[model samples]
Target: MAHETPRHWDRNMRERLRRGEAAALAELYDRFASLAYGIAQRVLDDEAATGAVTREVFGAIWESPERFDPRQGTMRAWIAGQAHQLAVARLRERAAGPAVREQVAAAATAARADYIVTAMPAPLREALELTRFQRQDYRQMAERLGINEDEARRRLRLGLQLLSSAAQYGAESADPTGGRPAPPRELGSR
Candidate 1:
């Protein structure tokens, strides 16, 4: 059989969930549990709390399948959003001071970046990973990937542009400069 598009899968999942099918719930859990757990862990940084958040996300979906509107976004995105919200709420509850609060916000931003990177197209992701992990320039990336320089630069630019949205996730408390992630600190510099 041909692969199903996300829209079809989302619709089927919503119908199955609305009907309260136990197998559907199990399948949903199997599919999204890792993504939900990863998001929660990134934001909460606690094994226990992340596990709780992951359970709560699935429980909420099981209890209220109607809450997920396919018109708004894909099922994966909705699940991710639920996980992020629950984890951030838990983090806020434990945060005591302004410094900790800032860290909480930063954690949320990092989680968003992770999600974006994971969801981006493979070409863009490869371009970004090469640059970030291997410290490769556009020219070098193109040479390594056997692509032209212009294509490499285009992929890198698009990937960075997509990742930049993570900075806007918590803009209310964002620092100056319109919420861009800070450049890496120079070696031996404070």
Candidate 2:
């Protein structure tokens, strides 16, 4: 069999693809899968993400073969472009994962802090609200509440101590160790 030139091969494949022939897609995959995978792997670096990008590019080609205009570029270039775009999109999502998680963690921590503050005794809660939440200095809090500076300072300290204890309690309770101090082991124990 005579080997067809690249241009003739691409043109014939495109025509078959436009006719919705599965063989055309198979030929295209056979020709370009490695190129697509290479481009995706370069951009994504991870095996799983690279595989996904390669599959998505071919899937898009399979679904919309007529979208490829012979006048615009060669099939190889088009497939590489598709792979690069998909890989970059996946990379962007992976890059943003940590930031999204941080935002969620900050929101959860704020909610937990709010719950602890609300459950406090009134005086401690009031002092924390004014000093910590409202960003008030001790003297300002004292003046606002019509109390002396010493009392304001004491309330703020006690509030901080209670908050610390609550956080520690939460940590201990959630620990797999069941909030108990580690037991002393016998010398002969495995």
Candidate 3:
């Protein structure tokens, strides 16, 4: 898939899978296994469950490649969505009382935030990473990214806004939705 366009790659992958090509499935697994594992891990927080979810996600995709519609989104999004849904279902299964349900919701919300940050456009991701990991302010981020302060501020703000939507995303899947409204406002807040 070197230098191949995503649409082309998606189309080719679908065709290959439809033809029952093992190599295609291997390629797809290689490309997305980590992403699937990470999303499942974030939601389930259990090694065995996460591993099971990863295999189930890839197995479902391989069994029904037609379910993946590139028109709706990229293959990456499809895989992530499936992994998230399955993990949430597993979480719901294990949850008992209302308190446990709320905790599950929060875990799902944090997982969604992780997915959002991972999927953010490069510039915004970089800005947020600088602030979070490097402890940089907007001006400092600008200097590090070689962009103006305003651009740095804009990217960070946009990234944060995207992250803040994690709660809403979680609510869509959360049964009795009550959790932190968003990812933590500060590193210390968590």
Candidate 4:
């Protein structure tokens, strides 16, 4: 395909970066900052690790600005590709630790909050509200949530497990910073 980029595609400021321009880099950072961080978050799942990944990615870019070849593609695509690759590498290396658990916890909390307010997918939202908020039983909320009663029960169980996992992550890890490696799941509690 002849790469028809989206209309909102931010213009590459590489031409303006001739003199190792700080402002140009800043603009690039502003443009792709969320993307880089999000990639980091998905992979590392640890606040510190994510930040480190971002820093290293940009820091490397800053050091070797000429590495960006415009003929290949726009700067955003190149940078996102680099960031995503590196972040994924870092994430894959991480132990399934408290960091992962804590990240899951944060996501779960967000989903729960979203389920409360937004006009989410039909039936699931109703089920969540009834079962979670109205304090109704699974069978009753099943009618509201839309899924089969068994499905509703499964969702409830998953939600509770996520919440509990978050609590455990916080209590066990105590630091969102991925400090020490986590023990294996097979090896029950020490």
Candidate 5:
């Protein structure tokens, strides 16, 4: 019997790879690398980090193929989301450090995003959008998301922190003003 390829082979292939097929994983890598790389590069706009994010996405596919539910969106959408999540988390963790130049370098390596990373999970992303990017305070972010201040703080602190570490690895830098500032950043990358 001949198999008629469905509309979403990439996702199907990825879903398969997730289920423990080494060959499928490699095939999925070859199939989605460019697309995934582009997405990661858009958000990160950097080379090394983009590559790392790319590898991580595939690694995730290998680790938890079950997570990619077709009901939520397309394979591309899933790729975009994972890339966004990894990028945001990367930036958040590395947001701290003594080297603005290094951070800039990291930015240089980031993949640009077609849709803003926030689009993946709007409310959570908005909640997680760093003050440096969304520029909203805990209260403002919470208000925007219609959540409570403590939840905002929790998301901003714990969620963002963990997000950062998972995406990359680093502790967020201390706010320049000692306390979190009120200005939202126009641009952000990890």
Candidate 6:
């Protein structure tokens, strides 16, 4: 059978799905599951979470095909949007109750920190890791690394400067539209 393009096939599939045709749902899954999974993975960054989000999206479509209105957008866009939302919701849920919003902020900060730390020179990386991760004070770090205390402080300062610059660059490049951040989801509300 020659399959129609998604633009046309989605319309027919939606109707079949609404009529409770199982094969239609399977066809839709076969067509869009990878796209949905990619969106979920990009948003959630965890394989288990991505799987959950993808399954939730397909289940929602199966249960309520009417929720997808053709006038609003193409079926692909609709599914991708749903995947993004579900992935974000799962992230918020993982943050635990009232701290959902804080979790997002913390995750972004952690991600940026990781990127900067990974990019640092070996000496700077060692200095920062000793102080931050190992809870070593300047004197202890200097003794451990066989450097003077002033040199240890200098390395830490340089590492922080690099991190700050990288973070600024990241923020500038993040969204070209200068739009506000996505609204945070309430924990357990989804």
Scored by CA lDDT, what does every candidate get?
Answer: 0.87, 0.77, 0.86, 0.64, 0.64, 0.80
- lDDT (Cα, tens digit) per residue for candidate 2, span 20-97: 899888888998999999999998889998898888988887788877776788889899989998999888878877
Residue-level error in angstroms, candidate 4, position 1: 29
How does each model score on TM-score?
0.50, 0.50, 0.50, 0.42, 0.46, 0.49
Tens-place lDDT digits, model 5, residues 1-190: 6674543675667567666789998876777789888887887778999999999998987898877777677676787788888987777656656587456434532422212344334444666664657687888887877889987786666445434432231112233433422322243321
CA deviation > 4 Å runs, candidate 2: 1-3, 98-190
**Lowest lDDT 10-residue stretch of candidate 4:** 181-190
Q: Write the per-residue lDDT of candidate 6 for residues 1-190, one digit (tens) a residue.
A: 8878766776887899999999988888998999999999998889988998999999999999999987787999999999999998777777666464455455666686687678667888999899889999989999999999998998988877766654454444444355554332321121
List of clashing residue pairs for candidate 2: none
Q: State model 2's lDDT.
A: 0.77
lDDT (10s digit) by residue, model 3, range 24-108: 9999999999999999999999999999999999999889999998888889999999999999998987877677767877898
Please provide the root mean square deviation of candidate 4 (C-alpha atoms, Å). 16.0
Best by lDDT: 1
Q: Ten consecutive residues with minimal summed lDDT in candidate 5? A: 166-175
User: Which of candidates 2 and 6 is the stronger one according to lDDT?
Assistant: 6
Better of 4 and 6 by TM-score: 6
Q: Candidate order by TM-score, highest to lowest?
A: 1, 2, 3, 6, 5, 4
Clashes by residue pair, model 1 = none
